[model samples]
Structure formats: C-alpha cells, structure tokens
Target: MYDDRERDTGTGRLITGLTWTLLLFALWLWGRGLTGVPHGTDGPATGDLFALTPAQAARLPRPAEPLGSALPQRVDIPQLGVQAPVVSRGLDARGAVDPPPFDQPGVVGWYGAGTAPGAKGAALLVGHVDTVTRPAVFYKLSTLKPGNTVRVVRSDGRVAQFTIDDVSVLPRAGFDARQAYGPRRAGRAELRLITCGGTFDRASSSYTANVVVSAYLTGTTR
Candidate 1:
C-alpha cells in the first residue's frame, strides 16, 4: 500500500475502513514513486483495467451448480506450486478487510462473512504479495493463466477444484467493486485470489496495482 505519509516507512500501508459493500479488500499498489492515494478518495485513471472484452469473457466457463457445505482448509495451485493453509478473517475496526498479520504472510485469509469456496457464490481469498524483507505466499499469483487449476481442500475431506477464467491487474485508484469481488455468474461458485502487484516503488514502499485472479468451480473430489 502506497502512502505519502508512510513514504518513509519501508513497510506497506493498508486502507482502513472503506464504505464499499461486500466487495471489500483493496491493497495498495507498489511502485518506485512517492505518490499517495488517500483512503476513500476517488482513484486516479484506472485505464479500463476491469473491462472484459468479448474474447476474454468467452474464455470463462459457466458452471451449472455449486458445491456442498464443506469449508475450505487449504488452497493448492499446482501450476504455481502454491499450497497454503486457509484462515477465516473479518473486517478491521475501520471496516477494511483485515489481512493476516505481516509476520504470517504465507497464510491465506478468507472473508468468512461471505460465501464459502465451494458454495454457490463468489468466495474471496486474499494474501500479501510480499513483506518488508521478502516475497509472500501470493507473490506469483499473477502468473497464473487461463485453464490452470486451483484445488481447495475442504473440512469434509473433499477437494473443490476451480479453473482459471481470467486475471486482471486493476489499479488502486479506479478499483471496481463489482469486478474485484462479485460472482462471475448467478448461482455459480467462483473464487477470486487477490494480492498487491505492479511496479514496486521503493521510494514510497507501495505497489501500483492489484492482481485479481478469477476462477469458477469445475469439479470436486470426495
């Protein structure tokens, strides 16, 4: 997160309580500058980052039904070689999505107030791209391409599998609440893996954009 006030601090900053709806989390972008995006203020030019053309939308698969009541315990992205524990988290006092502490950047945090991973709604899982010293769990999340698979091990001993539809790198200034956090289609189970991305500004200690990877339920294993 970029903050002119925290420009001197090497650690990234986080947006406090935002008035946005269920589509809640937004991490500060990274870059090598000292610009700051004030909390709740209108963002700079987003350059249509969230727009999906006909070609991009056509690549997404629409599932007929959702999964069962099992809770996700872990998320595995074989292509990225990412396997990490899932912890339920809520909003901070400021109403912003409360991410896991900086010391545990490898852990993924699920917005427990929303739909579960295998359920018939959009499930949101978020993590840090890096910490003060090194890269974090989702450092390579933006590298995932379409048709790649993500498996979520559930409490009921089932694995909920999702196929990648698309990935977007949205600038923090013009972040779209619906595109960033909404379900892809009605009555389908989807997942959005979010993290900070873009140019890292060593001067401000923030990134320039957020990487949102969109996926939908395709299969499950018992």
Candidate 2:
C-alpha cells in the first residue's frame, strides 16, 4: 500500500533540511573569505576610494571639520515594526563588519569611519541575521520594500528619517565596494543597511550573498 500523504510529508521535510544545510555551507565560505587578513594593512584609508563622479560626491555628506564625536545610537523602521539600538564601531582587520552582542538581536551597527547619518554622504549600517546560535537584529531587513521609512536616532538627540529606495542582493565577491561605501547625490543624505543572505555554505560558514537596502533622507525631526 502506497501512502501518498506520508510520502509527501517526508519529501517536504527532506527539502527543508537540505535548504538549511546549504545555507550553513554558504555562510561558512563567506566567513572564511573575510578572514584572510590583508597584509601591510593601513589603518582606515581616507579620500574617495571609489573615484565617485563629481555629481555623486556632491550629494554625499561633507567631512566635518573636526569630525563629530557622536554617532547614531538607534534605528527604527515603523513599517517593519523594527526599532533597534545601534552600536558604533570601525571595521575589523578581516574586512567584515563586527558582530554586536548576541543577546541584543535587533541592534544595528554603524561604521563610524564613514559618513554619519544625516551628513551629506552615505552612511553605512550593518547587522547580522544570525550568529551561529540564534537570529540577530536584521533578520527581517529583507522584508523592507521601497517607500518604507527608516529612522535613525543619533547620539546628539537628532532624528533623521529615510525613505527606502531599493533593496538588492549581491554575491559576496560581486559586491560593489564603491557604490556600497561611496558618496550619494549632492546635498542629500543616504544610508545602507547590509546583512548576510543567499544560500549558506557550511564549509565556509557564511552567506553566499549580502543583502543591501539603500535609502535616502525624506524627513528630519528636531
């Protein structure tokens, strides 16, 4: 006697398991690549590494005369119902954004070396979907769509709102280093939200692609 229902359930479970295994594998690969540790590393090089067009550079935030001491401390997306605190830090030697506290699953991380949110240029914020054990802050970031709103709370008590323009997924190796980190339209502020995605590679322990969400300033609150 062939049991169709039993067979279908078994097949479904197999597919789900397979998907998880593949995701783990992709993540492994991504982690391995980031750990190569560049030799003769210069501590945080300045200037435009992307050779941005003059027009693009004009849109980005201008460098502060003394560089502001305060940075963003929180992020809120009313549409997604996400309101996570943000931690400020520089990149690690491995060229990967550092992970935040595992317990704080909804926190956003700001790249302190680059433009601050609300500044003329683009600001970068990164979060992890998972940290080996559990899902982290940005697990739902992929759900954001165009026209969604994201708000940033800076340490100085200023709030900035950005409207989502686009979301994209790029292979880890194919990520646009310039566009992702470069300046934005003249006099307009921009933000980038990044996280791991695509299939996970267990052998490498990292995601195959990075999910990026780009947004532009739409409003501000004093």
Candidate 3:
C-alpha cells in the first residue's frame, strides 16, 4: 500500500513480478522500505507477533501438493472473519506491487505477474490496514496466529486451503523481499497476506512496519 493522501496510510510495498532470479539480487542490495499506518485510531497501532510452539507446529496439518496455476477470486480468513474479493494488480512505476485502490478498501490485491494462489510459489496479496476514516480489510490481519486457516477460491473451480505457519511484523528499515515473498519450502504453494503495521509517521505518511502472514498449502476443496 503506497501513500494515498486522501485514503490509506502508506502500506503495500511488496515485490513486483516473478523474476526472482534477478529481483532477489536487487532486493538484497537495497531492501524495499514501506510507510507506516496511523496510530491510536480504530486500526492496529502495531502488528501482533505470534510464534508456534514446537508441539503446536507438529500438530499442524501436512502440506498439500501444489495445484495448477489459476487466478484467485476471493480470499477468506475465518479467524479474522474476513471474506474479500481479490483483484489483479501490477507494479507501479517504482517497480513495487500496487495495492488495491483506496476507494475499494475491502478488496485484496494480488500480484498478477507473480505466482498465482495454489501454485508452487508464494502468491502475494496486499490490502489496506485502514483508511483515514476507518479500518479496512486487513485491519485485523495481525491478530491471526499460526495454524489459522486461509482459503483462496480460484477461478479453476478449486479452493486452496492454507494453514498459517508464520506471522511477523517486519520493519521497513531492512525489509527482506526474498524472505518475505519467497516460498518457505521449495515446491510448496505459499501465500502472504500483507498490510501496514507499526506506528504511522505523519511526516513520512507511512507506517514503520509491515504485517506479513505466511501460510502453506494444507488442503483443497471444490
């Protein structure tokens, strides 16, 4: 989520395109930095970090095999009570993934040039944490814990079921695009739901940190 003076705080600074071979090098050289969200309002002031205990991790379901490429239609996070439409998004002139339009705060933007949801790679999804006047689709994203489920309905008549494995609030100062957007395990289908977190800096019109929720494919349904 880039700055929208009249709408959302600075958010959505995800990597653009699937040219990981070269983008990885570029990000390593100069990590991407994102702006912060607002503070003390109806939105989250900072992201909540949740780590899984060894036993809890062991209790999670095993990873499911990856599916063929298909466009994501909607994303549902049961724990957050979120059911949002997914829209295709491309990179801006600055080479960063553009977020959903400010007017469509409830919509989630998917990186069209990258891996599709349910595919064998990390599919990037971003949303606004809050608008100037109220909380948006991802306002409660940080509250999600490991093992929560995320379901993505794809255009190919399949629903990809993912189990949350990691939730972290990464600082913009040294944002690691590869680590954040890359698949946790090779050949696994991964998903990242991202939004703004941390204190918003009025001067910079951005949030100090980004909330990144990582999940891996665990099941599938029609």
Candidate 4:
C-alpha cells in the first residue's frame, strides 16, 4: 500500500459517515442499490461490455463479528496510482447512496452505515469518474484488472488490502440490484468501487451504464 494514508486523510474532509439507525429505511434503500456517481463520457452501447481477466475464484476467513465500525480514512488503489480521501455516506431522502458534492469530485464516499471496510459483507466506495471540469478520482476505475490491489486505511489503525476479483458494466435501466450489490460470497470481507461508465447521454445528462469493481480482502496491516 502507499505510505500516504495519514497524510492524505488530513488533506480532505470526509462526507459525513452516519449510522443507519433506521435499519428498515436503510434496507429499503439498499434494495434500490447504491447509485450516485455520474461522469460525462460518451461510451459504447449500453449492453456492450468491456473484457476483463477472469477472477481467480477463492475464499478467506472472516471475523465472527463485525469490526467495531472501523471508518475508512482513505482509499488507495496502488495499480491505478490513486489515493483519495474517504467519507461516510448514508442514504439520501430518495434512499440512494448519495454522491459526494461535485465540487469535491475527487473525494470518495463510503457507505458508513453499511459493512465497514475489513468487516464481513460488501463495503462500498464510490467516486465520480468525471466532473463538470475534468476527470475525477475513479476516472480510470474500469482499467483496473484482477489482482490489482485496493488498500483502505481505516480509522481503527488497520489497513485492509483487497484484491480485485471482477469488473462489470451493466445498463442502468435493467440493473439487477441484488445481483450487482450482493456479496460475492458469504462470510468474507469484500469491497465494491462504483462509478458511472458507458455512454454519457447528453440528452439526459447521465451515463447509460455503470462500472462496478468487486474485490475481496486477502490480508491486512497495522
């Protein structure tokens, strides 16, 4: 992992990470899937898929219980040379994972109320692919390949290292929420990085598809 965890953590303010006291409300929203980041890119057809290396199917032991809400301070994708501050995000009034303000498009927002990084379940990290002016934090997220490492430094002092397992681009109109957002397997620490990809329909001012990168925890450090 990069050696700029603490340094970068201090550089940006996090989007407020809040707990889901309204579990019922949050669950209803989760069913809607976490969709918020928008990028301005004129990609291929909606159903057109980008080829990715097959993921090495494997598994790992997970903690018997959830880690004590270890809030992520920063996320680093070594292969992509990315280091961005992470903030916690809760559901919007519409029950979707709200994106960080466009002005701070470089910042990433973790679903604070969901599975914390390193915990058993899917932890979400979302960032914009592009902003009103230029490319954003996860602009090149689709280029990430299997085995590429994503290191997330949490507030609890442990660094969770996740290995890319799969990448998918699906049409937003017929997206399978449970299939896309569901955990790859039970009882494992996993991470999902999401951003807008595919064609940017100027007619609607939104992308026609989404890029989802899935990863699983392989190791950690203090």
- CA displacement after TM-score superposition, residue 71 of candidate 3 (Å): 0.5
| TM of each candidate vs. truth | 0.75, 0.66, 0.82, 0.75
Please, what are the lDDT tens digits per residue for candidate 3 over residues 118-211? 9887888888887776788998888888989999999999999999999888766766667876888987989999887777778777777778
Candidate 3 wrongly placed segments (more than 4 Å): 1-18, 21-48
RMSD of each: 11.3, 19.9, 9.0, 9.4
- Residue by residue across 73-104, what tens digits does model 4's lDDT show? 99999888898999988778776677687789
* Candidate 2 lDDT over residue span 1-222, tens digit each: 112212348785586456434433433343334321111211112222123456753564432222123478889988777788888755455544555655665777776655678665677787776665566667666667666778898777778878776666656664445555454455567888877655666676555666677878766676
Error of 2 at 149 (Å): 0.2
Worst window of 10 by summed lDDT in candidate 2? 35-44
Clashes of each: 14, 27, 8, 2
Candidate 4 matches the true fold with a TM-score of 0.75
Q: Best by TM-score, which number?
A: 3
Count: clashes, candidate 3: 8
Better of 1 and 2 by TM-score: 1
lDDT of 1 at 10: 38
**Which residue runs of candidate 4 sit more than 4 Å off their true CA positions?**
1-68
Displacement of the residue 210 alpha carbon in candidate 3, Å = 0.5
lDDT, residue 52, candidate 4: 52
- Error of model 4, residue 48, in angstroms: 8.9
